[model samples]
Target: MRILRTWECKIDKEIEKCKQQLNILSGVSTNRTTVLKIINDVKKHKDKALAKYSKLYDKAFLSPKDFRVKDNEIEEAYRKISLPFVKSIQRAITNIWTYQEHIRISKVSPLKTGGIVLDTLYSPLESVGVYVPGGAASYPSTVLMNAIPARAAGVNKIIMTTPPSKDGAIPPERLVAAKEAGIREIYKVGGAQAVAALAFGTETIPKVDKIVGPGNVFVTLAKKEIFGYAGIDMLAGPSEVLIIADDHANPSFVASDLLSQAEHAPGISMLVTFSELLVEQVTSELNRQITKLKRYADTKRCLKKFGVIILAKNIDECVEISNKLAPEHLQIMTQNPRALLCNIKHAGAIFLGSYTPVALGDYIAGPSHVLPTSGTARFSSGLSVNDFLKRSSVITYSRSALKTAYNDLAEISGAEGLDAHTRSVQIRLNSRSGF
Candidate 1:
């Protein structure tokens, strides 16, 4: 890893390069065009298109009957995994459920003043489609994080989709996790096509009210394109972590935490601190640790390409840089993590102290690991139970209340040249006296 002073002119160039790597554009690209074509093909051919794409992209040929995972398959998955592993998934489910229940949004009671009653009703979505990435590796934790919250929100139907392997089967661990999280309606499909199947519904897959989870560039682009057709969580990019450390921090722990995120292959890991010696120490530690990991080559490429070690003038400067980046995961390993937290304006998840690594949030931590990425934390938030629920405003006005506010309503509507709106209110008021 390269270390540089924050004041250097190269910092701006590096920041721009990072943003470009995020590829946060709606412009024309070969990938975007291909995704668009795939979406259109899926829309037109439906289940047949899904099968064709599965064969072409995933090299897994399947018929419509084989799209949804069978109950027998889930049972077989349970038998394949160890009992202790199943128990661990169950334990994690409890933790996630407990946290989601505490934070679940509640319906507000009617607020009555004079004769007007205003209220809001919160209701769970009837159905939701969760996209769990598969193919190279299984993300069972993602199943727990996304489905548990939806279940807690009282979502009646939760449908899940993942890419099938060359053998045209979902991973056993993923199936086990989905079953433990109370998600039985799972389909063996993935990628942009899976997203399309969820949005538009094939003969085998049922269309859902909302879609959630993380995927690669093509999947993210598919979500962006089909957003209006079906509600979607944020368009997630590659995983990233920014650590704000100090001289008092542990270099080994810092290096380990950074590698934990970098192991995601395309992930970005950064360190910002005032201690020059700590920078050198963490660099050495990262070099020492990177060689022993299974994903050593991929993680090293990620660190070298997207990672950075910044030498700030002071702790305040460290916080300043962190806020500007608005990273998906922010770890504060300073002398006083809490004191610096108030200064952090944007971050998907904040991990305080050296012991609280981003990995905790990724797996067992109460908060959903699905978070905003690529500076989107400045305006968005992590996934939660609220994402599976919809809120509707309720307005009730009695005759007296309508009469009292008639002129104000008319004035506002008339100002906007909306004569029909003004007249609608006036007619109601006029009828109050038995006209």
Candidate 2:
């Protein structure tokens, strides 16, 4: 990693690059043409399109009959995973469930005023589809992070979709995680086709009220296009971490955190601190520790493109820059992380102290790892039970209350040139029989 002074012109250039990475839709790979074609093909052909694309992309040949994973397959998945995996999944589920149950929205009594009743009704989505990416690796954590929250929110129907291997097999760990997370419905489909299947529904897969989870460029584009037709969680951009450390912070821990985030090909990692000595120490540690990672090439590439160390005047300057970045993950590896916690205005998730790594949050920290990426943290938040729930403002008024609101309502309706709106209220007020 290279060190750049905060006062240098190069730091401004680097910030612009970070902005570009945060904008998920602007990349060349996000071409809407291919995504639209896939969506339209699936919309028109349904199951046939799904099978065709499954063979083409995932190399898993299947028919409409084989699209949905059966009960036997999930049981088989449990057998394939290790005992330790089961224990780990159980712990993760318990933690996530406990946290979600606590934070979930609940019913509240209506606000009663003079002849008026106002209610805020919270209801879970009827159904939700979770899209888990399939590749060389299986993201069991992804399954837990997405589905557990929905389940906790009281969503009755939770289905999952993931790509299959050439052998027409989904990852056993992923399947086990899905089952554990309260998702019984698993689909053997992936990519834009899978998203389309979920959004529009098919002969096999049921249409969901909303879709939640992350994916590759294609999956992301599919979610972006399918937003209004069905609800979407968020258009998550590249994963990123901004680490603010002090001279007292452990250089090795800071470097490892940055490298772990860099494992994502398009991921970003930054170090903003006041100590030039700490910057040098971390850079040295990054060079030493990165060689040990399995995904060395990708991590190296990520660091080369999106990694930087900024020499700040103090922790306050670091916080100010961090607010502007609105990073997906903000790790404060300072001497006193909580001392500066109140000033952190942006960031999807903040990991405080030297011991709390983003990886812990990614796996078992009880918060959904499905967080808003890029600068979206400024306006949005990480996934939780709340995302799976919708609120409706319910209002009721007695005849006396209507009379009280009549003048203002009629005046506003008339000003807007909506005669029917005013008449609708007048028709009720004018009725002598009701009074």
> Model 2, which residues run further than 4 Å from truth?
none
lDDT by residue (1-435, candidate 2, tens digit) is 667787775666767776886788885463788999999999999999999999999888898899889999988999998999999999999999999999887889999999999999999999999999987679999999999999999999999999999998998999999988889889999999999999999988999999999988889999989989999999977889999899999999999999998898778888899998998888899999999999999899999988878888878889988998999999998888999999999999999998899999999989999998879999999999999999999999999999999999989999999999999998998898765
Name the lDDT value of residue 118 in candidate 2.
Answer: 99
lDDT score at residue 295, model 1, on the 0-100 scale: 88
**Ten consecutive residues with minimal summed lDDT in candidate 1?**
19-28
| Off by more than 4 A, model 1 | 24-28, 432-435
Clashing residue pairs found in predicted model 1 = none
Per-residue accuracy of model 1 over 1-435 as CA lDDT, tens digit each: 667687775666766666666555545488899999999999899999998999998999898899899999998998899999999898899999999999998777789999999999999999999999985678999999999999999999999999999898888999999988888799989899999889998788999889999998899999989998999999898899999999999999999988988899888888999998888898889989999999899899988887878888899988988887889999999888999988899999999998999988988878899999988999999999988888898998888888899889888998999999988887876674654
* Candidate 1 TM-score, C-alpha based: 0.97
* Top candidate, metric lDDT: 2
Global lDDT scores for all candidate models:
0.89, 0.91
